[model samples]
Target: MKFDELDGKMRSFETHHDRAVMPEMYVVARIDGRGFTRLTKEKHDFEKPFDERFHDYMLTTVQHLMNCGFNIVYGYTQSDEISLLFHLNENAFSRKERKWNSILAGEASAKFSLLLGDLASFDCRLCEFPNSGLVTDYFRWRNEDAHRNALSAHCYWLLRKQGNSATEATQRINRFNTADKNELLFSNGINYNDLPAWQKRGSGIYWKDEEINGFNPVTQQTVNTIRKKLYINKNLPFSEEYSKLINNIIEISGR
Candidate 1:
């Protein structure tokens, strides 16, 4: 067979199952750390529940992803997972699902591993929503999840510190209600409401217009300029207000 004919035949086998996200739909790529429990707890011994160092590393990784050759409008991270909201008009790789998954996973894993000085990996999956309302709901879901996880972690760690084994802690936490967890922390001298907002609500990264005053060398005059920069929000709102925030981001990005 001719070279071109042979190449064409092999390419079909590789792409036979390929799929692309539909146009006009919002794309959210969620990248999650693989085996991060072992990596964070057993290997690196990062502070339990939350660590500033680990949080900074995750924030840096999210910033890298926001600028890593995609039309991402917003980035969110909590715990060991990241969610990236692509621009509404993004058509990169013709909206190929596999391309987005592979490249995002590779980029996040590489960036995080470099920051951690170890071999770490991440897996990526895409979520598609038909309307902005659904997008708002999606983020709201993750936001609430962060709250639940934070409460559970604080409760679990408290039990562990009180001489409960891993299994005992897990079992106790499993039986506790939301009020019970809060009371547990309260009784132990820790207030769940007093914890850092970032731990409970996660963090959001979005582009903002920053005003800069500088001297124009050629004109020899002071000038004002607008620069686009990423803004990190650690204290995110909840319920209806959170929905508004997500919608506002989508609306501004569309503009």
Candidate 2:
């Protein structure tokens, strides 16, 4: 055969021999929790406002999910539930939907379970949503609902703290003007109006540092600090083998 014909034959043979599967384009994972109401009630009832402790619990939960091989692309929180979006093609961690879904649920529940172990009040569960739109909307709707419910509850608690009767407190809280209900919170000489944009996006309980320095993502933006270390071992290494394996996966998955 001519050289061109030989080369063409080889290329065609390789193309026929190679068979790699494509990964799914989207994944909708739902995570939910309970016992948070009891926790919130205790915090609201206590003299100390539920800021630092509650915030820590949330940060720890998010960090826990990251460690379990999920990339939290976006997060939205309502009263007790949080909706998180993860990267779709996580071949290193999520090769299959079933395994990835189980891991996500397990990590979230485990974190909350530990955080509330002292109080013995909260439990969490994950909901599976193979449909992307439903999964995304589920969190958005519920989170906003949670925020409204929290405000109403807080208003009632505040009225009760002022020695109002149950009926009176409910009425007063429900009667709060829109502006009053949406008023920003101030603490330790810091105005809620001055917090960073991200901090203001929703109520984040753990961001006490912003109280002192005064956050302004407008002037000072925050970047995600995910990778703590990036070192490859030189000796006793399967580095080349590992790289080939990753490339093979990417190629197979068509990423």
Candidate 3:
């Protein structure tokens, strides 16, 4: 089939004097796992900062979200929390936020439940942010906090594993001065192995999953598999559907 036949327009670029449609302000969706901390504490030996089995479980969770169509612009694993950023193209998706977010969350939870069986648990929700400086700052703030929390947890986990009590471990970090903590966390967020055992066993952004059992690129097959579910490769891709949905919802809600 010709590209234009499927898209209903010239798929090739055409430079024109037309002013580019200003994208309806970008939407930022943040999804997090629920019950992960308790699950982590229960399943892994906290004394050991790197637990292979536990890390594999944590990464499988991340894999599910990315597959479901969300772009994980960022991630942090400290205290068993994963934070991700999804920028839905307003130009290509209408009701973009609700449709994608809902689909991603549902696909993730369902697939995760299947992948880990009973070894782990998860719940997810979307938190929208104003496309403003302050809102942008809020993401930076929370992500940074997540970074701090993760480092503290890992540092303490290591210390405790080596025989220090929880109180002593906490005090040790409070007193340990390091000039490169931020850089360390930021780097690790982009590269998973830098993280503890649970995170390392898991994959990072742009990696494919094999054991999950759902996708075949050559067959042009797709599954509701959590790992790659968010990719916007639909024949229609729901860009127009999003516009109609957003307009209708706003009209009713009067927000």
Backbone clashes under 3 angstroms, per model:
0, 1, 18
lDDT of 1: 0.94
Model 2 segments beyond 4 Å from truth? 1-25, 40-49, 91-102, 116-150, 165-167, 175-177, 180-255
Off by over 4 Å in 1: none
Instruction: Please give, for residues 160-251, the per-residue lDDT of candidate 1 as tens digits.
Output: 98999999999999999999999999998998889998899999999999999999999999999999999999888888998888889999
RMSD of each: 1.0, 17.6, 16.6
How do these models rank on lDDT, best leading? 1, 2, 3
lDDT of all the models against the reference?
A: 0.94, 0.47, 0.46
Give candidate 2's total backbone clashes. 1
Model 3: per-residue Cα lDDT over 1-255, one tens digit each: 787675655433332322322354434444556676565467534435545555445456666665555444433232344545444333333434445555656665666566556444444455554454433454445544544555565666666766989898778788765434434334445332245432322222332233355777888886655443222211111234423433332333222
Better of 2 and 3 by lDDT: 2
Report the poorest 10 consecutive residues by lDDT, candidate 3.
Answer: 229-238
For lDDT, candidate 1 versus 2, the one ahead is 1
Q: How accurate is candidate 2 locally (lDDT)?
A: 0.47
The TM-score between candidate 1 and the true structure equals 0.97
Q: After superposition, how far is residue 14 of candidate 2 from its true place, in Å?
A: 40
Candidate 2, residues 1-255: lDDT per residue as tens digits? 999999998989755643322364444354555555555665444222234455556656655665566644444443345555544554644345445555666777778668756432323333444445544455445544544655555556555766889799777666776456556132223343443322222322111112122445876954543333211111111234433432332243233
